[model samples]
Target: MPITLHDAFVPTAQQILRAVRGLVDKAERHCAENGVADSELIEARLADDMWPLPWHVRSCWVHSGYAINRFKTGVFTPDFTDIPDDWDAMRDQIDDALTQLDAITPDTLEELAPQTVGFELGGQRLMEMTGQNFLLSFTQPNLFFSCLHIL
Candidate 1:
């Protein structure tokens, strides 16, 4: 069977988003088990100059949410500011991304798959791609990269 755009994009994004959510779970459990504060995990980075953990989490949220909205609306608006500082905020961001994915129907994805659109960030045109190519090449890689960083 041929893969639809929805199949190519939605379920993969959803799975990665769930894995990101699980990272939050593991962090909370680790903090509780070791009597460490969440800040210890939230602020830690592999290097001093690297983004802190919250930035990774925020990037995951932003990438997932941005990919969904951009594919659906053909507008590439992405923001990673206002990083979630605590568990509730992090979970909320994950839930919000999941909700956005859930709102897209298979028909919508089919309608989008053949359309060529601008991929931009901050008013800069990154490139142009058909929706199917956008999903397969652009959004999926960004989502996975952010998810790996979050994990």
Candidate 2:
């Protein structure tokens, strides 16, 4: 049988999920190497416009984490956005994210919701669940690279 668009789309989408995980891992390491143990750095403030780039980058990581839980039928909702307030557990969370995304299949993607508050994307009101989910997956890389550091 010929492949449907989804057959191609899911793997490509998985690569983005994987890349996001990679960058987040890189960022976490960068943070650790430069950090002063269990302390926080002032957030970056380079952007001069609304929806700053760091927000975009961090949201991709956060949303990717959210996507994983929603993707699995028999999994717990991980506290993706929870600041560990500690170092080791934080690194463990990053590792856990990579493991989760590596496990996704089309059957898994079909289980996720976009976690959106708005009614549309690009001014086109979405009518189906799968459409928006895949759309989010498509744009995830856009969000990730817009602020990710070289790593």
Candidate 3:
């Protein structure tokens, strides 16, 4: 069978988000077992120039469920504000993303596939493409990148 836009995006995004949730649980367990504070892991980063753990987690949500919602608006803008700095909040973010994904039916994505979505940053339009392309080419990659960093 030919793949639909929903088949290509929603399930894949949800799987990645679920994996992220599992990793978060493991990190919390590891921290607890090692006598390390949860905040230490929350604030930790692989490099000085990169955002901390919370940002990666937040990005997963932003690039997946949040990005889907933005497709309806015909513009995609990266939101970097209000990243959660605590464990509970981080989990909540993931949970919220999962919930959002669950609400998106296949017909929703099919209807959006041909619509134009602009990629904007800092009041500038960086690119424009069909919603399908925006999701598969851009949002999906960013979602994976964020999930990888979280690992």
Candidate 4:
């Protein structure tokens, strides 16, 4: 059978989102067991210049579920707002992403596959590609990167 755009994107995104959700749960448990405050874990970063745990968790949503929704608009832009600052909020963000992913029908993504999607950041056009390419090449990698940081 031929691989549809939906085949390539939605299931993978859903799986990654679920993994992120699990990681958030485990992190909460670890913090509680270790007597580490949620704030400390949320604010932790792998490096001095990198974003904290909450940002990485939020980015998973932004690059997966949020990116899929934005494809309908023919442009892709990274959202940096409303990043969760606590453990519960991080889990909530993941849950919201899962909910959004669940609402996406295969037909919607299939229809968008061949459509043009411009990627813009900081008011500059980074690149323009088909929706399929944007999702597979750009957003999926970004989702994985964010998830890796949380792990």
Candidate 5:
């Protein structure tokens, strides 16, 4: 089935969430590596700080679900914290968000406004939303790491 804006949003949200998961996983491994390497851990912290810093835990995906809804009411706000000290807590939420994303398809997406509508900040309205840009903002990582570290 052809993907729609809705489909794009959910998966893109999931993708962002997955990035968090990956970062958390990397952090965990780095911590477990017994100081053999600190670069990845340092990079993880830097990558995380790339987004608006969360004073507490709101900025993290564990609560923000990719920070798609900043106010938790679909509004843009300063949210998402850092990764949890115990990464295990993140599994279920990430899985659930991914599942929610899977439900998105062209059919549901068609109901959404065009790319120019702009993502909602709080009113659940698409006043200036544009699907294309929204999708990119959700999926694109401003602080992406290179393959060299993963290898």
Candidate 6:
């Protein structure tokens, strides 16, 4: 009875990402059922200083995607230049993230576990840690934060 690295990372992240997709579906349904434009929700924020709803959804995908990408490559770049601005595009973003995460098999997670991983921001090295810590501490928390905001 032990929790392997694959159990700790892939399935946990996949479950949260799947929930992110569900949030997208719910948003679409809510808008249609109420005859309210998706923008009405997507563009709204809990406060003026906060990022809008779409940003939250995008971050959920981006954070998880970055973990996968960075674990494989040791580098991450901010490239939301083609941001998803509509409901369909948002759902596609989540789907694309799910696809990327799905590619990380149990074997892959095992390979990554003892390796060093670095987090980069703005073309500068941010921090480096073991892959396990990076996935469990930084990546999972940020991804969950994004998901929580959707509710």
Which candidate, 3 or 4, has the higher TM-score?
A: 3
Best by TM-score: 3
Candidate 5's residue-wise lDDT over 81-137, tens digit each? Answer: 344334465554456546655655555445433424334445465444344454445
lDDT of 1: 0.80
Model 2 regions more than 4 Å off: 1-42, 48-58, 71-81, 84-90, 110-128, 131-151
lDDT of 2 by residue, 25-144 (tens): 665676778774323322333454534323444444444544445433322232325543333444454455456555656554443444332224355654333434433544444434
Q: Candidate 5 at 35: error in angstroms?
A: 6.4
For all predicted structures, in order, the TM-scores are 0.89, 0.43, 0.97, 0.95, 0.47, 0.90
lDDT of 1 by residue, 10-127 (tens): 8888898898888898998999999998899988887788888778777777666567677677766667768888987888888898998888898988988888767777789888
- CA deviation > 4 Å runs, candidate 3: none
- Write down the lDDT of every candidate, Cα atoms only: 0.80, 0.44, 0.92, 0.89, 0.43, 0.78
Worst 10 residues of 1 by lDDT: 62-71
Q: Please write out the lDDT profile of model 4 over residues 70-93, one tens digit for every residue.
A: 989999998989999877888898
TM-score of candidate 3 relative to the true fold: 0.97
Ranking by lDDT: 3, 4, 1, 6, 2, 5
- Better structure of 4 and 5 per TM-score: 4
Q: Which ten-residue region of model 4 has the weakest summed lDDT?
A: 36-45
- Comparison by TM-score, 1 against 6, better one: 6
Models sorted by TM-score, best on top: 3, 4, 6, 1, 5, 2
Model 6: lowest-lDDT 10 consecutive positions? 74-83
Report the C-alpha displacement of residue 44, candidate 4, in angstroms: 1.4
Our model 1 lands, by Cα RMSD against the true structure, at: 1.7
